[model samples]
Target: MKTLRFVASVSFGKDSLAMLHLLLEQRRSLDEVVFYDTGAEFDCIYRERDRILPLLEERHIKYTELHPAEPFFYQMFAHPVHSRKTGGVHKHGYGWCGGSCRWGTTYKNLAIAKHLRGYQEKVVQYVGIAADEKNRIGDKCYPLLDYNMTERECLAYCYEQGHEWLEDGVRLYDVLDRVSCWCCRNKNRKELKAIHDNLPRYWERLEALEAVLGNMKGKPLNEVVSCS
Candidate 1:
């Protein structure tokens, strides 16, 4: 019988690196490694991925990049710029997403599913939950857990694999434990504070987004955390 095809879901994070390493170590051939480009991610994530692209080529791994039809801003603000209310028009407003909202993930994953539709082989999606984060693990295979690897091991693997790419100056996990969109409501107090400290303008921009939306208490993402 033919072997199953593996598809690793990567976020350019520690756990992602560990899982991919394990897969390759197992002599498993990957059908593809998919990275969902949310377009709202930190710049460093892209930089790290760019650094590793050459390695993927050297390894002859098929790396795929997928993105939703609309970026985060456009997805959040679905209405047209032109409006009778504003006379001229506004480029942005709001539609339906916040910290509690999983709509953005849903849309992105559904787009990926469209790509996954044609595969004939049994495909396994590799997720990057660390063994320590087993609670978050569900039906998906947590390679870290399967390999008995912890988050620390994942970090070490990435650093060893690409120390130059994994620079201390701009590692996302250094500032934020979890990297997501800049304006995600899911960001905790520390992450928000990190945004304010390292990327003050971005934080201001997020606040500006809130200023335009005008529904902080009434909604999820409209409220900016007190970075003070």
Candidate 2:
């Protein structure tokens, strides 16, 4: 019989941070904490990871970081596309990922799955979904939901623990709902507008990508810049 290994998947977001804190507080048996880096996350997300590193070290919890085999830009701009009709290859990349075609999510999951395959033990992955997000609950173990913690409660708990996602005197939670990949095409207009207004460098990069890729979500990047 193989041993069971308990692992927590963290994104350094409010829910995940709260879940990790609760697991620690309750003295749960945690073998490791795994984080899948999308390579395009906001700076605050990385900073939050840095903030939590000491606690993981203090508790002697193994921390593993997994990254996609291909870079985000390469997947977006240079990936080869095979044409079924002509039996030829199109060098143009997959363009902007959105809806069900989110390649970033695919890459992240694949990387994590590949890493977990290395373990001979049975891996019980703990996700950080909140009670309010019951629709997102799957087969994974959700500690926050088990504790009846809502999304708002999770954020409150993280703030109470000094796990606020802050960058340049700006609180990220105040502007955006999720701190996922910065280049994600699924972001709403409000989130995109916030980035356009606050983060010029990132906005510029988005504009550059849009220039090369033509349009995203059937709209010009300038329209997002003028979002009210």
Candidate 3:
């Protein structure tokens, strides 16, 4: 029988990197390292992706960028209708999820799996979800979760191996926690403030979206900047 092709999900962040490190350390023969670029990714993520490419190159690992079609939550909102209270506005907020639109997790994740349907060999999909993020796990899964390593173990292993690069200086204090779309409802107000204070352009774009979609109601990032 032919050897299977293993896919390590890469997300320009510490946890994913650590997972890759662990896989390599085990001498596992992986065919590819894949990243699902959900266009809504943070602006800084592009640069991080480049830096990690060389590492993959040195290891002869094929790195692929996977882009999703319109985000999976396209059906969440109705067509924009001008409202007297909000004035002429676009319904941009329709896609924003609260606890109600839990679809955010399943939809995007399934989309990512759908995007990776090409490598048909027996496959092992390495997800970056850590043991600590219990809430982040879901019912829909890749079938290979049983053999996967958790984020906590990945980090400790990276540290023991002297990988300072994994120390991604982001506020989450994790090298492995590479989250996308700062405006995501899954993120706390502190993370949102960080985006506003550090990446002004992204913050402005999100604010303008709020104006059109009115999803945030009257609450603005400026109001909670200090707390974050």
Tens digits of lDDT, candidate 1, 1-46: 6557778888776788678877887876676788988887766678
Off by over 4 Å in 2: 84-88, 225-227
Off by over 4 Å in 1: 1-3, 79-98, 163-168, 215-228
lDDT of 2 by residue, 1-228 (tens): 999999999999999999999999999989899998877888889988998899899999999998777887888888887888887885668788777778888788788888888999999999999999999988889999779999899999999998777766668788888877777888888888887777778788888988898776578877865865
Give the Cα error of residue 198 in candidate 1, in Å.
1.6
Backbone clashes in model 3, listed as residue pairs: 14-175, 14-176, 15-176
Write down the TM-score for model 1.
0.79
Q: Among these predicted structures, which one has the highest TM-score?
A: 2
Cα error, candidate 2, residue 130 (Å): 1.2
TM-score of each: 0.79, 0.93, 0.67
What tens-digit string does per-residue lDDT give for candidate 3 at 1-228? Answer: 645767777775556667676677667767788887766665556766776688789889999886645553343345353667878875543566544555455556786677666555656676666555657666433222344556656656555654443213443334223355545656566667666665667678777767655555236656766555
Model 2, total clashes: 0
lDDT scores for all predictions?
0.71, 0.86, 0.60
Select the stronger candidate by TM-score from 1 and 2.
Answer: 2
Of the candidates shown, which would achieve the greatest lDDT relative to the real structure?
Answer: 2
Cα error of candidate 1 at position 16, Å: 1.4
lDDT accuracy of residue 72 in candidate 1: 71
